[model samples]
Target: MTMKIKKILLTTDFSDYAHYALTYAVEFADKFKAEIGLLHVIEPIIAPTDFTWESYDIAELEKKSREYTQESLDKIIREKIPDKIKATPIIRYGRSFEEIIRCAKEEEFDIIIMSTHGLTGISHILFGSTAEKVVRKSPVPVLTVRDPEHKFEML
Candidate 1:
């Protein structure tokens, strides 16, 4: 059977695992003639009590996030993806899994690819695996990469 993928959503945390996933995402997109959407979701930062509404700086945070996202996007576009594949970068603020789901639904992407830290011990307890939650909750297929093994295929 022939497989055709038009759009793909890739979520990244700018980690090493995520960089590996990005490589796979780019290759898959190229092979399928798909458009890629790269998303980075910033988990909400809780401020101290002393930091009131006036002290809160949403704009600055947003600006920093956008700059970082763009830097990441530029790096990937330059080093990872080939000229044949087209991709867009997106930055959002909120829970990671929720933002991923929302972007997938709203963007109507055919595939979702991301990376997992494969965290254990205290780290796992503190920050739940976004990749795990995404795989469980995503209505569409989710391709998560941890190690650099196995060939990537669309499900």
Candidate 2:
């Protein structure tokens, strides 16, 4: 069966694993001639001090983070993707899953492609996988890249 994926949203944490997912997302987008939306979520840094606002330079940190992520995203597209692909890079601040879902809805994305952290033991229990939560909560189809050797699947 054939699927119509006109708009695809790919979320990245700017990690190597996310780069893998981005590669797959780009290949799929190119195959379908879909518009790609690249999103990077900056997880808020909660301060322990009572006067949290003063403790951290939130604006400067956020600015740096956004700039770094945008550069990385731009580099990936420039180095790996063809000139014909339509894409945009979006930087947002919030919980990863929430921001991803919000962007997907706001951008009218037909699909979401992201990489699973594949955490184990305490880390997995303490911080649940964002990819898993996104799959459960996403209104549209969510594609998660987990297995290191598995091929990308289109749903």
Candidate 3:
């Protein structure tokens, strides 16, 4: 069957690895003439039981997180992604893999593209892999770009 990618979801953690994946996503979007949706998921903040954390504090933290995520997204759009590519920025608070899968399914993205940290051995066992989890759980196709260990041309 022929695959038609109308909408592409690109998940980023604002790390070097994620940025590397952005290059691939932009290239694919340009070639396919697809709209790009950029998503950044922030882990929910847990209040310490020992210290009485006020609701206002939590609110402030959420505000800051949203602002920071927006700024980063804007920077990528302005500097990395080309103007011709239709792109939207989204910020959510939750588990990364779950949030990504939810967004991809709910937004009706044709595919999800994200970067893998390329961790292995004990570190991989301890930290697990978000991309791996999403690949298994996501309803749509998931494309995982690994760290830039191999030289590849970027369009």
Clashes of each: 0, 0, 0
Give a tens-digit lDDT track for model 3, residues 120-149: 348558768888899889999989998868
Reference-based TM-score of each model: 0.81, 0.83, 0.87
How accurate locally is residue 40 in candidate 2, as Cα lDDT from 0 to 100? Answer: 82
**What lDDT does candidate 3 reach at residue 120?**
36
For residues 7-89, what per-residue lDDT tens digits would candidate 2 score against the true structure?
99988776768878888888898899998888888778666666757857867877787788889879877786677998887
* Runs with alpha carbons beyond 4 Å of true place in candidate 3: 52-56, 118-124, 150-155
**Per-residue lDDT over 23-125 for candidate 1, one digit per residue giving the tens place of the 0 to 100 score:** 8898889888898898888777666666476666877877786788789877877677777888888888798889999999988998899987632347567
**Two-way lDDT contest, 1 vs 2, winner:** 2
User: Which prediction has the highest TM-score against the true structure?
Assistant: 3
Global local distance difference test of model 3: 0.88
Cα lDDT computed for each candidate against the true fold = 0.82, 0.83, 0.88
**TM-score for candidate 2, residues paired by index:** 0.83
For model 2, name the residue pairs that clash. none
